[model samples]
Target chain A: AQTVTQSQPEMSVQEAETVTLSCTYDTSESNYYLFWYKQPPSRQMILVIRQEAYKQQNATENRFSVNFQKAAKSFSLKISDSQLGDTAMYFCAFSASGTYKYIFGTGTRLKVLA
Target chain B: DTAVSQTPKYLVTQMGNDKSIKCEQNLGHDTMYWYKQDSKKFLKIMFSYNNKELIINETVPNRFSPKSPDKAHLNLHINSLELGDSAVYFCASSPRGGANVLTFGAGSRLTVL
Candidate 1:
């Protein structure tokens, strides 16, 4: 069994600033995948970024990046130049390399203040 | 075009009634999954199908049945729905059975009265 934890229930960031959302997981599997998903007001789950446990280097998208510490079992998401559109509920998920099930965290509601 | 789509964007039904939600993906993925997001917004996997075969069945009650006619389609049917069953259901698909990223649908909101 695997579990993902997002300690923060809610977070706020000023416009144009940067914000980091923390996440931790417990998994006995050596090979796995970590993901961050964003659900906006439209309720569409969008993939933010992903990291492979085998990859020591972090994963970075245009404005989203992940700080993955495999040894610590930590995977955090960082959003840069946050805009109002970035306000949404973020979730951290984990899946074994060859599994179809994704274990998701409770989620953190983010608000971007102007 | 929508990569993954679920029909009946919203469903309102009475207790003990039976309902079904349809999901389809155009990505030609071999694996599809059904997840339930409760009122508190906690998403949990209920069932998973690979190439129309059941792969993962969580601790969910047997009342909730999943049917996959093909690799690209997976539908969820719930019998004797209860108030606790009111939640948002999401359908997602991944390219393969490996570490491929999942693409989720807009979600179906089911309200059991």
Candidate 2:
């Protein structure tokens, strides 16, 4: 079974600053995908960024980027120029190349102070 | 247009009662899923359907039943709800069977008193 782990239970960042949320996973499958999702107080799950295991280059979306180390099985999300609206519960998820199930991490609550 | 939508954004029901959460997706996607977010904020997959076919059924209890009327709608029904069943349920959709990016709906908060 594949499991995603988010070490940081909580994180805080000032407005316009940068913060990184650490994530690691245990999986034997080589073909898979990783994703970072944010859930605000509204409780809507939003996709922040995603990385494919086969791709050596990391994935970046606007102010969000992921440092994906396949060998280390680590996928970290970095949020730059953080804003108050960025405060949310962030989760790391994993899914095999042809699997319909997605395993999610425990989640990290991020607070962006103004 | 809303890609994925769930009805009764907030559900408050008594214990042992039966309740249902409805979900629909207009993205014309072939796959849909249900996930539960516990009070501790741990998200876990409960069920997945592809074109009205059951694909993945996690370790969820038998009291929880998922019904897919069509390719675009997947509904979750809970029989004899318990306090432990209180959590936020999210419905999501993907274009294909697997490994595709998911589009999630604003969750339905279910509280079993």
lDDT of 1 by residue, A44-97 (tens): 999999888999999999999999999899999999999999999999999898
lDDT of residue A113 for candidate 1 = 99
Would you list the clashing residue pairs of candidate 1? none
Task: Give candidate 1 regions above 4 Å deviation.
Answer: none
**Each candidate structure's count of clashing pairs:** 0, 0
Recovered share of real interface contacts in candidate 2: 0.79
Which 10-residue span in candidate 1 chain A carries the lowest summed lDDT?
A94-103
Docking model 2 quality class: high
Winning model by lDDT? 1
Q: Mind giving the per-residue lDDT tens digits that candidate 1 earns over B25-76? A: 9998999999999999999999999899999999999999999999999999
Runs with alpha carbons beyond 4 Å of true place in candidate 2: none
